[model samples]
Target: EPLPYSAILQPGHTLGMMGGGQLGRMFCHAAQSLGYKVVVLEPTEESPAGRVAEYEVVSAYDDMKGLDTLLSYTQAVTTEFENVPAASLKYLSSQIRISPSAAVVAVVQDRIAEKTFIASQGIPVAPYAEIRTIEDLEKADNTLFPAILKAARLGYDGKGQARVKSVAEAVEAFKSFGEVPCVLEAMLPLKKEVSVVMARGFDGKIALFPIGVNTHINGILSSSVVGVEEIDPTIEKAAQEAAIKIALGLNYFGVMCVEFFILEDNRLVANEIAPRPHNSGHYTMNACLSSQFEQQVRVLAGMPLGSTDLLAPTIMLNILGDSWFAHGGEQAIEPDWASVLALPGVNLHLYGKAEARKGRKMGHINIVNKDPQQLIYYARQVSDILH
Candidate 1:
């Protein structure tokens, strides 16, 4: 049964966050805006979210003192990153509310387990095989050649994955990845990639944002455009329903994302699920009536989910640290933010990190306008400056 409103957190109560990345930073903004206090448990002294939070415990996630301190201040907790140790959530849940519980996070943390859960829900996914040992590789079907071997855990942003065209290549890639447990997924004839970001309330009410068309470069997301043009209406509805079905099956509470691949034949295949606000949904911050971050806060606080209606067409461009360094990586060159911001509809957000390394997420820009064509044109201009 759904938790009742008596569990609904009041405005003045403090909320706890597990990870202190950009997602946590945005969540703090939303919670604070609603007159709630947030305490962040992050070891980093200068984490993006820690910098903005009212109280920050600069201790490791496993530190009992830090966890206790966070619990002392907050009645409810949520995690920004999914890889946070499940044990931490299990320990804290005995005391306070933790939305998208440890069980849900655990299932999504491992690639094989996540895909298995999605498939069990009657959702279609790519053909794949598991590789925990050399014998597992021997048992893999030859037709799955030209597959991508991905680490079962701790993989993100295109890291911890390698493409293999044969069993020999798969063996080498597995060894290169420290012989970790992995999943080898057959590549599909992908025509486009898109994602749906939605919020499931404590009462199981669901609110969905419009489909976001995503473009990635080198396994890292490069851009996302809301209100994708020329998409088949029936396909879009099916994708949205599939995401909702997955959320309902998990009995999830909070903003969640389901990524999909539109095949050459126009079939939509579930790619992966993110149990938190997604990077592709960053456009929601400016384009929607209520941002995904705010939805996260509402769900965790046991409050009603907010409206997800798109206020306007928007395009989001990711700014990576590679843009700060020239092609040779010799000279540091910061993009002309002033020039980019000069665009009428462009909104720039930079995470305050002191050092810039290759492929690191530095910030993002959102371009909002009535005409999708104009947003696309401006997005290209902005991308040129950043890249």
Candidate 2:
């Protein structure tokens, strides 16, 4: 039986967030905009979200006092990152409810468990094998070639992943990543990378945002465009179905992202899962009826769900502050904001932070276009000028 709204959460109440990154900041804005309070549990004093949230607990994840204080006010808790320390989550789970609970977090935290779950669900994934030692790496030899070595835990933003193109590279890459448990996956010659970001409310109501097409540069997400240029209904259906299954199977009440690789045959093979609002879905803010952040708030607040339909075809360019060209500067290197703003349908969001580093995400820009190709060209131009 489905749980009642009152049993799950209350509106105009507080939602506690586990991490204080930019995602946290956007989620706080969404929650606060809708008349809900937010409590940010962050490790850094200068956390972007913590700076703006209603109540800020600037302490480690294990800070009992901070956790206790947050739980006292918030009706439910959620997270912006999947790498939260399970011990701290366990501590809080014993006291207050954490939606998309600890089990989902634990399962997604380890690459092995994630792959196992995907396979058990009969979902198609890249051919992969596990590695715990040099011997295990050798066993992966005949299984898959042109593979990637990935850490089983705590890896994101393209870190802890190394591509092995040749026989000797596999041996060296495994050793390079050291004694950590790992998974080696066959590299697919993908036609395009797209992702589905969706939210499942406590009422078992699932709303899916548009699928996003992602492009990467030097192992980092450089850009994401929403709504497949030539709407692949088959792909779209499969992507949304996968998200629904994952969210319901996880018994979740929050936003979740599943990245997909469009095989040459047009089949959708999942790349990975993100248990929070994803960078690829940033386009939703300008293109959708309701942003993913707001959808997350709605879900966690046990409120009516938001529409997932895209209002316009949109393109998003990430502002990685640490780009060697311009983003790496400690001080802000202002983009030609006037020029960018002059462009029709352009929306810019800059995260207010003191310092900028190499490859660190600072902000993003969105463009809703009647012509996606033209928008892509202009976006590249603006992003090039910005970086």
Top candidate when judged by lDDT against the true structure? 1
Candidate 2 structure quality by residue, lDDT tens digits, 164-274: 886578778777877689888888888988888988877777888877788998778888877537748888898888877777777767789998899888878877888
By summed lDDT, the worst window of 10 consecutive residues in model 1 runs over 1-10
lDDT per residue (tens digit) for residues 242-330 in model 1: 99989988878889999999999998899988989999999999999899999999999988888899888899998898988755667
User: Which stretches in model 2 have alpha-carbon errors above 4 Å?
Assistant: 1-5, 8-11, 322-324, 327-332
User: Against the unseen true structure, what C-alpha lDDT does each candidate score?
Assistant: 0.89, 0.81
TM-score of each: 0.97, 0.93
lDDT of 1: 0.89
Number of clashing pairs per prediction, in order: 0, 4
Q: How many Å off is the CA of 101 in candidate 2?
A: 0.5
Clashing pairs in 2: 321-327, 322-357, 322-358, 322-359
